[model samples]
Target: MNGIIGKKVGMTSIFDDAGRNVACTVVEAGPCVVTQVKTDDTDQYNSLQLAYGDKKEKSSTKQLVGHFSAAGTGPKSDVVEFRDMNLTKALGETVTVDEVFTEGDKIAAVGTSKGKGFQGVVKRHNFRGVNDATHGQHNRQRAPGSIGAASYPARVFKGMRMAGRDGGGRVTVKNLRVLKVFPERNLILVKGAIPGPKGGTVILHK
Candidate 1:
């Protein structure tokens, strides 16, 4: 597995070789430092721990500061691990977007989706909430009508879809094509939308 920590820079459109307009998400990927390298003999598994994005010294804990120092790097805001990487790298070495991915490569992006805060069933679960406004129905159009049966259940069952919080959860979008890679600026253009709000952290894996 090859992966790196990155930030979502937002979305844009580009023209492909055939002049077809393709919607793509711009990501500021990598220039990540290898903080740790786990081997099967030492860690019982093979994985590469990477760190990216600078963090203020006051905002980071002392332990984290020491950890980054041990790796010969400064404090980082994001840290992630990738297992089964093809190439071998030593600690403190940097990994860039162009090193792992290229144009037309299929990859997966993992990140937190945007928070919608408190939401109704109609918007949260796509419930058609009392479709008909007839039979003296007024403000109950967006209501979640009935939650449970009267006699048998007697209470709302677990895993029931109702009005509540929405979004702001880990989401993985797979099979996204790498539209372009700008190693000079450490940017990656992935075709299609990815999870998380603008400037939010994301992990791109292949």
Candidate 2:
């Protein structure tokens, strides 16, 4: 597996080979430092922990500072681990976009989706609600109609889709093609949209 840490720069449309415009998401990947290397003999797993972006020491805890210090790097904003990487890198080594991914390679993007805060069934769960205000249906357009039964099994079931907080959860968008890669700028344009807002950290794996 090959992966790198990146930030979502936003989305743009580019013309493809056949003169057709294609929508792609711009991501600023790597130059991520390997903070830790876990081995099966000690940690019981094989993975490389990579850190990207910069963080202030004043805002970071002592333990985190020491952790990054072992790698000979300053505090980083995003730290992620990957198993079975394509390369064997030592602590403090940098991982760039071209090393892990290339144009036309299929990859998966993992990140947290944009948080919509508290939401209603009409918007969150796509409930039709009361679409019309006909038969004394005042203010019922966005209301969730019924939630429970009359008797036996009177309580609402668990895992029942209802009005509540939405998004701000881990999301994985797979089978996305790598449209382009700019090594000098450390940018990768992946075909189609990925989760999260601009400047949010994203993980791309192939």
Candidate 3:
């Protein structure tokens, strides 16, 4: 369950050894600092608290400043805990992208999907409203018709699909193949698209 915090660096295509075009999402992972090492005796559980990216000193809280300072590092923009990390590392240690993952490894990326604010059922829930334009149906093509029954259940069902806010939620994309690893650049190329828009933060779990 080793993992690291990263930023989605957009997508690109590369040719494999077989000359097959492979679509991959580029991620700038790590050089994460181990801010804290929690043990069962001290914290009632075992986990590694890692911090990555950079933040302005003025923008960071006093508590956060003290926390990273304890690790001999500056303010970090993202922090995450990995409970199942097998390797033992001391606080203030650095973890890189290539140190945990390699080419051909299968990984899972967790991120927030792009927000589609106030969407309709047609796009949100994939509702095919009023297939036919006839029967005097004018602008009801994308409408969610008849939310509830008239007599039996006077109100709409609790889980009924309707138009509302969409996306901008935590999403996990599993089994993404690790196409390549650039240790020097701290970049990892993973096959297939990952959640979130460009520059969004993502956690790569191996």
Candidate lDDT scores, in order, read 0.95, 0.94, 0.94
Task: Show pairs that collide, candidate 1.
Answer: 1-84
Every model: Cα RMSD to truth: 1.2, 1.6, 1.5
Better of 1 and 3 by TM-score: 1
TM-score winner among the candidates?
1
lDDT of 2 at 9: 99
The lDDT, on a scale of 0 to 1, for candidate 1 is: 0.95
Alpha-carbon lDDT of model 3: 0.94
| Clashing pairs in model 3, backbone N/Cα/C closer than 3 A | none
TM-scores for every predicted model: 0.96, 0.93, 0.94
Q: Which 10-residue window in model 1 sums to the lowest lDDT?
A: 129-138
Give candidate 2's whole-model lDDT.
0.94
Span of ten consecutive residues with least summed lDDT in model 3: 148-157
What is the C-alpha lDDT profile of model 2 across 94-163, one tens digit per residue?
9999999989999999999999999999899999877668889989898888888889687898988888
Instruction: Give one digit per residue, the lDDT tens place, for model 1 in 75-138.
Output: 9999999999975899999999988999999999999999999999999999897767897888
Candidate 2 least-lDDT 10 residues: 126-135
- Backbone clashes (count) for model 3: 0
